[model samples]
Target: YLYNGAAYLESTFAAFKQRLVPVNVNYRYTDAELVYLLDNSDAEVLVVDTAFVANVARILAELPNVKLIIEVDELGEGPNPAGATIAGLVHYGAAIAAAAPAPHIERSLEDLWFLYTGGTTGMPKGVMWPHRSLIGSGGPTFKPFGFAVPQSIDEFAALALTVHDGAHDPIRLLPAAPLMHGTSAIASWGVLNSAGSVVLLTSRSFDAAELLSTVQRRAVTNLTIVGDAFAKPMIAELEAAEERGEPYDLSSLRLVVSSGVMWSQQTKEALLARADVACADLLGSSEGVGFANSVAKRNRLAPTARFRLGPDAQVFNDAGERVVPGSGERGVLAVGGPIPIGYYKDSAKSAETFRTFEGRVWSVPGDFATVEADGTITLLGRGSVCINTAGEKVFAEEVEETLKRHPDVHDANVVGVPDEKWGNAVVAVIGLEPGVGATEGTEAELRTHCRATLAGYKIPKRIIFVDSVLRGPNGKADYRWAAAVASDDR
Candidate 1:
């Protein structure tokens, strides 16, 4: 499905009901990228908004596997791309009305679920998830402390329907991230699996005010967002509202959750100050879940990138040995337990990611981290984007976070570009606060500020200020773009 959260939920659920696998398409993908993903996934039916029709039409000839097209009346302007002359073109509403009720199909634990990765390092690949593994280990199953998961589907359904007397009301959740992203999709599933209502933001773009308004209108109990990219703007909007003497009514919100990107400690504290809600930062990826998580509440805020490691998670060195806490050794984070089978149609990549460590299978998604003396895991960003400068490994995220800590910096993306002297030079591409100019003095000030918190080697070799740093719809940094910009400057 190629749309926002609202349509994504409806279409994904419908496909799930029929035991059919649904592939996620990043709506922001260009025609060629979309064609590559669609063809690679072997998609047979496409459900899309009218706005994307032209892009789809351009690639229609190449997508012979796509047998049917369902056009939703989202914009409600143009004629159906699949008109009478077009074979297998059907309106979404008409198709639903005309089709008979689907017969019950027994669902199996082996049923497939595909979530394509964001392709920051390479082309996006589908991660194959089994229904059973996804529910039990993909961070969705509502297993209370000391409670075992139900054995059967019927038991699980019964558990989902259970409502205790005087218990908190059914969770009304608002996922602010794009639904196409696994973080939002899995979160929405968790809500629906628990019989809760998911209130989706219908705006084409992220608007903090609109999201806050929806929360107020819907009496939403929970809100999900993608790290600093979403939280920073929302907090800014809240501060703006406060200045106007019209603060949003966030009393109904019980929790605010963030995943998929880095959520800074300052942002978390800012949010807690404005609303009396618990904030959770999840550290995981499409291939694994619950590697580590940090929770922030009023008067008790977790530091940025610091998380209490999950039960099934462990940090391992290059030799596959588990890294000991306080050793100060960097390693990859791996999770044991129910995890995805592999990347769909990519056995080589799958084998490299999913490996048997000490006789136990684990999913290591290439996130670099270190275990502190207290056993806390401090994330150092993904290894794929890690910069190698003079043989010293520098995590881009750590530097980016430092850059963002500056008062004038709005956002930052760091990348490693090829350098004759350093092998790969650490380059920082930053977006400053509104009305802030990209002056040499500002760059010098940022470098000096970074030096106070970061090691000399970890500091960016070159800082390029831009109006905006490239990011995906789900708030993930576009490292490719950053690298290109750095290369061009070099």
Candidate 2:
């Protein structure tokens, strides 16, 4: 109920209602928005966030389809707004709670669910998610972690619900993040699927002290986050908690899970430093793929996690063939177990990426990986941006991860650009934390540091300090966005 996206929250509630799907009139939509949602959803009743009524009134013509426009309150805290010119609108909570529960209907496990994909990628396509298919193909692969802060009071109240039940009940998660992001959505679903609470967020802003206090007050046990952007701030927050004699009673914390981004070594170490929580890194991509590994797996894989012999890892040659034993060539990471149902409205993309392998279909995300003699999957990096720099092939992620460890840097993105001498020169786009600064000298220092950890050829030849790195809602780098933004600056 605390969600920022009216459409998404409506979708979730529709599922909860089982009979009636909630139709969210867009926030930007005037009453005209009401007509659009009503027409598309075939919805008879309209629920308006009363604060949004003024906007809704602009398109009064759109209200013809609305049988009832139930106005919602300040959300979980106060009564509904008073004095609306639209005389028919009533309070939302009372209306729903007062309504008799509809009798359950027999539903096929394969019953269709309309899912709205990110419009930013292309036109918004409503993908059909079948329950059985999701359980069979995607459930096992869901290694979800959430990173959220209360964006609004409603959202915070929602977050509080995620943790609070009764004083007798055990404290649970206070998942923070936009639910539109697949990771947080999955986590929220996981929480509720287990009969847990979900706290709402407001303002989308984060306050360490407030968050820590909430965790302590609720005795929270699990927190999920994207490893890179969130880890440092969290560590600092926790440190402040300990320093002020108001240490969060974090004994309830059991797992500090991450997945949205690769957990750099420092971030992992920092996580272990604070909480004795088990960290699980699920590696996957949107192209119907999944994989999971951690420092434990990497360390045991030893010299070549990418090439080490493991049942989980494999190498494929260019001939649509799997490599022989110990071939030592990097190939795309093909994931087994659960996978996505493929992209909606794009069959060609689905066919290109998903395939049957060794008799079972595998969702092979295009990450360049290798299996060492020990069979450990050593992830070289993503395959798409494999850069041949100075006659030597370089994986930008490897170099970026190495450079990001420097105290001065928050995160780094490496790309290869045309060069007269090297064919392609390594480019480093760095984003620094607040108050952190870098100069040409700093770049030089970073170069020297990289030489110690990376081959000279892999080290970036040119470094451009970036204000911020672009990330998708899933917290994955939008290489296309970065490339575009990179050009804008130049």
Error of 1 at 241 (Å): 1.7
**Reference-based TM-score, model 1:** 0.95
Q: Tell me, by TM-score, which candidate is best.
A: 1
Across 441-472, the per-residue lDDT of candidate 1 in tens digits comes to 88789989999989999988899888898888
**Candidate with best lDDT:** 1
Instruction: Summing lDDT over every window of 10 consecutive residues in candidate 2, give the lowest-scoring window.
Output: 301-310
Tell me the lDDT of candidate 2: 0.58
TM-score for all models, in order of appearance = 0.95, 0.71
Q: Could you give candidate 2's per-residue lDDT for residues 1-490 as a string of tens digits?
A: 1234343454465564474443223333224434544455455665555566665555545546656666665445454444256667667667667878768676555554444443323333334445444444323322232323223446535544544654234326655545645555655555554335555445445455555666667777666667666666677887776787755666667665566566666666655666566655555444332464553232332121222322343456566577554577767677655445555556776675666777776666567766656555667786667788767889877887788778788877777777789988788788887788886589789888998878778987777787787765345666656556555554
